[model samples]
Target: MINKHVERANRVITVLFYLGSTLLFILLILSGSINHFPINKFYWLSANTSNIPGAPYDISRWTFWGLCAEKNDKNVCSNYLSPAYPISPKDNFDTTTNLPPSFVSNRSTYFYLTRFDFVFFWLGLIFTGVNTILYIFTFCSYSFTKVVWFLQILASVFTISAVCMQTAAVAMAKNAFKNYGDDVSIGPALMGISWAILFLTICLFFMTGGTFIKKGYKHHQNYVEMSKYKEDALKYQQYMNSTKPINTDNASNPTDPYSLPSTYDEGYQQQNAEKQQQQQPVDIIQKSAGVIQQNPKSSVKFFHFKKTKKIPHNDDGSV
Candidate 1:
């Protein structure tokens, strides 16, 4: 049987995970849109371009929307652009004199990858938002759970794609800088948040899908009742077999639906014997007895016949 408390707890946990994922996604999307405490701090790639004369800033950081140049303790960021282009010395600063060979050779490769990463991130965020809005409806019916599961699947696909693209683009950029003998490092904050969101998304997907396997409350109750009835019937049969001799000859199969109660007593069994016999005629009794004997492990109760009453007939037709 499905415990109501356990079900409620699972729902609460799933909701919490969903909320966490949504919040992280929002944070990721807003990282490069503005220059502020947390946002200005979050970037995918950071490099020391102090020695590169053509480089505009001593230190450059790549964000989701644009690039930021950090000097001293302050950051001077460019205007936010949708689908921001990645940091390529030749493309961004308009000079490639002291840039890495890989940066020039693979400039277009980084550009398209970062752009698609931005796009897929937004797509994933949108799907997650839809799921958040429709999540409450899932509690109203099982059909809504299925709907939410589908939405979770779509969200997972986009989120995974975004994370993969972001990781690939940033890793490639960092490697190029390293190979050029320049000081470079990948941004831990951005990568951490992105991967965290993906983790939450995956967890939510499986939790929502698990609801499909759950049986309804009514179904659980029915199953429990049938199980209890069978248990009681089995116990009674064992008790009777141990206490009394088996009348194999007189024993006839019975087809009656009635079964022995859990707490069997001699008085109660004797009193109900006649009524049980009345309910199941002799033919039914013979059949049921045969069935029970064949399968002694069966839950069907065996009934003992006591006596049958006879009706008197009038001698004359007029009477």
Candidate 2:
């Protein structure tokens, strides 16, 4: 079951990485100060009197509209409402708005800025720092068991915590800007879609980081087990090499007895007995041949076999 989950994690991380790349690209194009999206209406205040320009933010950062705007400030760089009318150049409230205001531009974005944008940014930064430290220590050269696990646990904590806080930061920043001036800005409507993509990207990063830690942890466990096995095997090898007796009969015998283990000593003796039985047959043949050679006609009684007759069974007086 753990193996299946591990595979699933791999697939999820791959898919999410691609998704995150797309979101990052979009975010980059949206967060810049260029004219991709009207980030600040004040920058375009000279464009037209009747025509209300869009927020300075792009579709990715539409949530930032009116974030810096005041209740009655028309010159506010991020104001999302129209100026009051009879639309005086002096008044801040909109009276006859021709177009909606804007706050963010669609030119460039930065991940580092998100950490500074919300209440949880500081916390996230701290966790990210811890995660980075663990990542570095994990590559240490010494072989201390469980240090790797410790690093992994640390990494897991930071990875999960940082991602969660980042998620919260994104949400809180959006909500704060949305509630500005007691009204939802036009920017969020246009750029709010990008938030979902950004969230997906963040989710991918966190999952991948956590998966990496698990892989390392499992690998560390395997190493520890293997190391123990090797130590035991080495001990057994040393005992065999040192305590085993040397073979003295190897030079006299055709085969080496020391090669046989101590438990096989009885079997070795039986094998020697069988060898003696086989030699007896050869000795009898040799002695008979020698006697024949000593005398050309040796008086030896050679016996011949004859068939014995059996009486047949007869009944009564018949034969």
lDDT winner among the candidates?
A: 1
lDDT, candidate 2, 103-155, per-residue tens: 12210122233323322323333333343344334334323213433443443
For all predicted structures, in order, the TM-scores are: 0.64, 0.37
Predicted structure 2: clash tally? 30
lDDT comparing candidate 2 with the true structure: 0.40
**Model 2 misplaced stretches (Cα beyond 4 Å):** 1-22, 32-115, 118-186, 189-194, 246-319
TM-score for candidate 2: 0.37
- lDDT, residue 319, model 1: 30
Best by TM-score: 1
TM-score of 1: 0.64
Q: Count the backbone clashes (under 3 Å) in each candidate.
A: 10, 30
